[model samples]
Target: MAPRPRFSSVPHHALAALRQRPAVATAVFATGLLAATAVVNRQLARKAERENPPMGRFIHVHGVRLHYVERGEGRPLVLLHGNGTMIQDLQSSNLIDLAAERFRVIAFDRPGFGHSARPRGRIWGPNEQADLFKEALDKMDIDRTVVLGHSWAASIAAAMALRHRASVEALVLASGYYFPTYRPDLAAPSIPAIPVLGDVISNTISPILARLMWPGLMRKLFGPKPVPEKFAAFPVEMALRPSQLHASAEEAAMMVPMAVAASKTYSEITVPTVILAGEDDRLIDVEQSVRLHRVIRNSRLRRIAGAGHMIQQTEAAILMAAIDEAASISAGGGSDPRDVMTTNG
Candidate 1:
């Protein structure tokens, strides 16, 4: 009892000292908070992977491992997902099945997203990713097929067409950001891409923040239309993993710059292209697709009314029609304007 009374007094004395040295106390609190955050995030990532295991095959190309889903049987069609997501994004949208009906669909989990390896020490802009996928497709013996890119991946599709003009037979760009514009909101999420600070943030607070903001982000992405029930199959936890958070942040940081760099070569893309977008896309303006259609001379444009940025999920029927039109055009077949649905170009 006497010893306990002495220890109690010691704690009081230590508390008084810590209160006097506010800086030390603050540092201690910060350290504790970070430790807790790390523990929680680590557990969450493990749980996410456990619950949602990889459902596709893997290929090693140029020292990178890519996870991809291969389905259907016809001309090869490559599906490239947008920022922050994996192949499952397209799979959940039913786009894979729909396209697989007429084409051999191959949807890739782009570098750093999903189960793919995103090696550090090099920048992975749209062009770099395009080259990687080109090699991977070559290894898979895919020579030419229509390439569909949604959101950020649209840039990658364009880069692929420009770099290997003969490989991409056609292009279906949907809700893509093709030009640089003022995007102040990107500043916050991009913090996790900043070297040491980025590592710490991505491993801790970034995932937490992403989880909190996911609903609103989904709402915006599929706005003017409710987020489809099918999208529930998308593993939000997987996207919230620390690794994906870093990849997403990096993409966000490079979005504007990549757009500016890629925009210069848009005119050189001679592939048959079709641009699709929701008339009321809340995440990226529908005008982006309209403008891209205007730039690509051999492009068809379809602006779906009452749709949003996640047209892949909400407008899979319309998108499938677009893919069919693209494939037909790639084969030198012409589009029947009556079958063109809602063409503006």
Candidate 2:
């Protein structure tokens, strides 16, 4: 008191108050951390966009903006990439270029992936996406074409064929989940799809966590075979943006339920179907393809050796061949001897 420690006495009182109100202190610290994380995420998202600009054109349809890459000239082939990827995924696989040589390839970002806009207030299940894509294709004057869906998009492809039978001539389903299966891994990612909580997590923590986990995930996806160098060109940061992360989370949340709903209608698919599966797919069982092939009477199953979930990257040639097979089979070829093409792993 005699020393007149004015500043020291004030700080001691403030520290005592903060210690007394630990809950408030925790809330304050959390708020600051979240604010900082949000700022960093925004900067990173902007940088990603600047580094990886859109490689295709945009089309506004049904109150949504869709991004797509068009190439070559021949029978129309519409590519629907799986969850967490965009047109670049197909392009990176070289399937787009290979198919472009023989078919008019149109690869889309599908609702929320890449540069596409995904409007909220609606559940974008397989049927919903199928409806949107159907309207979009119609707007572009694509009355009928071969539709290829990889992984989760496989359900969308099936929905398109089921809903618009006349429009979807054939289907190429790769690494697809046709039936409901136990997927505990989806739990963590699905958290970002929750309403208020999802918004906060996607904007703050998901992107950061994804950066750390990307490599291991890629390895698992392309396991049993080394990941191709070309896949490194994929803009991982772009996919890590908050909006895309939310979209991916939503898709993960919808995967099982969508499969449950879609499986009931698979046997009704009369279009020429080609089921492509990686024999050594670590993520999904190849038996999924086998079951799908059995269900779809007009389907052909091609199991690749030494391949994984990313058959597009590991077996692009085989994918191209499958596309050709879909096109050929769709052209009214009566019977085929090789309904099931299996190569030993």
Model 2, 22-88: lDDT tens digits are 9988988899999999999999998988998889898898899999999999889999999999888
TM-score of 2: 0.94
Residues 244-283 of candidate 1 have per-residue lDDT tens digits of 9999999999999998898898989888888888888877
Error of 1 at 100 (Å): 1.2
Q: Pick the candidate with the highest TM-score.
A: 2
Worst 10 residues of 2 by lDDT: 329-338
**Residue ranges of candidate 2 with Cα displaced over 4 Å:** 1-16, 333-338
For residue 150, model 1's alpha carbon misses the true position, in angstroms, by: 0.2
TM for every model, in the order presented, reads 0.93, 0.94
Clash tally, candidates in order: 0, 0
With a 3 Å backbone cut-off (N, CA, C), the pairs that clash in candidate 2 are none
